[model samples]
Target: YANSTASGGRRAHVFNCHTDLYLEEAERHGWLIQIKSMIDLFDEGWTLRSIRKRLKKDPTCTIDSLGSPSDRDITPLRQGPPQDELPDFTLDEMHRQIVKFIVVDDQAINLIECPEFRRLIRLLRPELNDADICHRTKLRELILNAF
Candidate 1:
């Protein structure tokens, strides 16, 4: 009776071991398939945004399955409070820095007047608009005062 019981326990253990191995193999196979699909999408020139949208629609797909840090969604830095809410001293310092850039770089006063330049500046500092930007005359005055 003891020998029969021991043999039955061994058989059960062997069955469980096989089942676990099979499950592990299946998981690995699925992961490989996901990786291949991602690679294929890249080959097709799919942008990260497009891929992310597709993943959102597919319940089974995950961003992690891409396995690249560059593929991950990046959060933009938090913008500071609007300049109107800032102290006068802070605004003065900001203007001084702008004047310094123009003087140090030997940039033309008219550079600030360029539509594209203003657009780029606004893009970087959303709080600033044309009115907040120093005019060429004001910039010139600041430059002269510094010397």
Candidate 2:
């Protein structure tokens, strides 16, 4: 009987006494199989096989390739705009943003809030009110006449 509030959002990891305790074994084994399958496919390629043969050794691990470079060269790409030097992008500053990007004509806007159109739409989908077949068929006739 585990209490819901006892752990305070912490997860309980129960260790198996008889078997391996390393939690990351399943994740590592999956990655190992994926990498081995990729390598097997690479070995099947004639060009890659020839390259491997020319090297006279199995491919070295590429996992360490992205480690810190020995060269002390560091290039800073734009030391970001100083403090409040950047423009304000908050909603208050963007009051005119909608007007700048959107241009809706009168007819399209009128259709959205038109009473007649709303009534027609409600009649077309009368099943929303759980109306019977006869009532729904009568509403359909009125909806067709409105157009």
Candidate 3:
């Protein structure tokens, strides 16, 4: 079992295959109802089939799968006052940040070529296409133009 607490103090308990069977047994004994009342929580669209599919794909996957906890731990399934929508940054703003990282932080211009980095960018800006991602040459040009 894995427990996660959201920023809003909402706690989610994720049970593995073994714990899932235990929950079934507990429900048979009328314990699940009591547990549910105490937690004031219900399912958030995760069905057994979906869980199995996830487990099949990634045996170590967590239900609160946001990203690696090293980067950020976001609980998208929490119940609370809806999170404020983040203001969208324009393409220029994104390019500026990239340039800043490359120039100020001495980040490699080729960092954008990393698959994980590209995946993160896609996740953050789903509307952008592959062509929209600036390559190392474009980054070099951007640095030259900025200076």
Best by TM-score: 3
Best-to-worst ranking by lDDT: 3, 1, 2
TM-score of each: 0.37, 0.15, 0.39
lDDT of 1 by residue, 58-126 (tens): 656454353433443442111212345643545567668677555434356667687998788778678
Evaluate all candidate structures by whole-model CA lDDT and list the values in order.
0.49, 0.28, 0.50
lDDT (Cα) of model 1: 0.49
| Residue 49 error, candidate 2, Å | 49
**What TM value does model 3 have?**
0.39
> Considering summed lDDT, which 10 consecutive residues are worst modelled in model 2?
98-107
- Which parts of model 3 have CA positions greater than 4 angstroms off? 1-88
lDDT for 78 in candidate 1 is 19
RMSD of each: 26.3, 23.8, 18.5
Off by over 4 Å in 1: 1-89
Candidate 1 displacement at residue 58 in angstroms: 80
User: How well does candidate 1 score on lDDT at residue 112?
Assistant: 69
Question: Considering only N, C-alpha and C atoms within 3 Å, which residue pairs clash in candidate 1?
Answer: none
